[model samples]
Target: MSAKIRLYVDHLLGPGQSVELTREQAHYLFGVMRLAVGGHVALFNGKDGEWLAKVAEAGKKGGKLTCQTQSKPLHMPPDLWFLFAPIKKTRTDFIVEKAAEMGAARIMPVQTQFTNSERIRQDRLQAHAVEAAEQCGGTFVPEVADLQRLDRVLDDWPETRQMMFCDEAEVGSALRLAAQEKGQPWAILIGPEGGFSDRERARLSGLPYAHVVSLGPRILRADTAAVAALTMWQQALGDWL
Candidate 1:
């Protein structure tokens, strides 16, 4: 595997120009990773595309790197989105990481009536998404959306894309639902730990584009629900198919 370093949007990088990485990034690269000057690393700006860079200077407090050439063009991902209720801090981070790893184009934090976490640090979640992309060797990083009310998100939902609601209330085979959702841009909705409110469930079920599906016989946590739903989607209508 090639050496890669995840960077935030604070630094400007281009061919033949030196960009100074932040103090924290400097520590991780030079101090922790023991990467010396002249070592090559890969970088990507969510907008500017992926680039191969060489460490120009290694310093105790900070360091500089120069971008060499573009490794890949800015390619957009599929239209799949993972719309999930935010859980605890660590679990939420795990969900963001897994969503990026699973190739979700967008990770949305939907705030339901039964949702436990009201406050979500979007920057932290975005950072986790970036790290996941770098770790998985993915050129595109999934967008981490801010916390929005479920109703608001649904009200503004695009009519073209289908929403696969992972309903725990359903008890049957998943293939039936999978067959109905084949070959469409989709979003998977996972309820919070306490599950969706009655009104919310009804609203989701009423949507013409929403396809209510079951993960299995057992109940799952919000984080686990996300992974299971995404896995099922990938196997059925996603890229795996």
Candidate 2:
């Protein structure tokens, strides 16, 4: 039977490679999951492709797994960054998890002028991204960046990367991107719950690479807008095509 458990590990994955599990991983596999020696598990390290591994040693504190063969090739997503202003605690986590599942190359949290939250637990959000990749059968996990000012991020934006700015003021505008060329680096930005200030909107509008678009006729909450924006971009210019 095929291994049903998929795990994201930090060690290298290759033929004949033995991976040492941490104490927490050991507890989850042995104590919680009831996996025993000789049981099979799927492993991925975000660099190497997924590998089918056999449990070589099972102990109370730690364990080891030996790689048997590569199960899947490393599939990298399009070079797309997901940028958004942090919202509530649970919703912020939701955004990070969904961004990982939806094929974002990187996840960035920006503090906008009207942003609700000032700081975020970067480690916790990153853990959510890893768990999301494991559950969604993805070989790559997007890195979650710490919260930064939106203005600063815009100032240092890459010249080659295009930005899809979801402007709340542009409500009722059709969400279209057919004119955009695919295969280029891109980013999708979702504003905070309170929406972007007039000054912020003006600054974004003046940018040469920013494509301001609306989600729909009505204003959407920050979390909902994030998912909607990702879906739209993926269908138009992302890997979903």
Candidate 3:
């Protein structure tokens, strides 16, 4: 029978490997979900793809699962990194979830001059990404990084990865990403609700590897901008095509 639950595990998965569940994982699978011995679960470890595992032993606070067979191979997203300024808590959570769902290889909370929040719950946001991957049938989950200064990130930017800067100020400028044939590592940058600072805008615009594009005439919230930018990138240059 097919498993209804997909879980992210840190353990390595293989044809004969047995994965031991932690107390919290056991509680949720055995107590909360009431999964007993012989029950099946889909498991993925980011690097190992997805496997169908059967409960070999069950206890109140722990359990053991043996791998039956591989279900899905590791399907990593494009070499895309999503960098955005953090906003409200719920909205920030929403951005992380959607970024994972939309195939971001990494999610970074950038500290811009106009950014509203000063800190972020990196662990909590990572959990949200895991849940999003589980619920959305994704075998790979993106890493949610801790808050970092945008300037530092840019200063240390690798020349290999191109940056797609979504600037609202460039309203009339048309984005022609689809026609670009060269395949280079890419990243998308979404500014805060207050928008990019003048210095940030000018710096990005002057960057040799940055492509400053518009998201239409209307200004969008930080969260909305993330979704829009991902969609455009996926359709143009990402694996969606």
Per-model tally of clashing residue pairs: 0, 0, 0
Select the stronger candidate by lDDT from 1 and 3.
3
Model 2 agreement with the true structure over 129-208: per-residue lDDT tens digits: 99999999999999999999999999999989999999888966654687789899999999888889999999998999
C-alpha lDDT of residue 81 in model 2 = 98
Give all candidates' CA lDDT scores: 0.83, 0.92, 0.92
| Candidate 1 local lDDT, residue 87 | 85
In candidate 1, stretches whose alpha carbon ends up further than 4 angstroms from where it belongs are: 4-14, 72-75, 173-184
Give one digit per residue, the lDDT tens place, for model 1 in 30-58.
Answer: 88888899997887766667778889999
Ranking by TM-score: 2, 3, 1
lDDT of 3 at 19: 99
Whichever of 1 and 3 has more TM-score, that candidate is 3
Q: Which number leads on TM-score?
A: 2
RMSD of each candidate? 2.4, 1.0, 1.2
lDDT per residue for candidate 3 within 176-195, as digits (tens), equals 99876546689999999888
> What TM-score, computed on C-alpha atoms, does each candidate reach?
0.89, 0.97, 0.96
Q: Which pairs clash in the backbone of model 3?
A: none
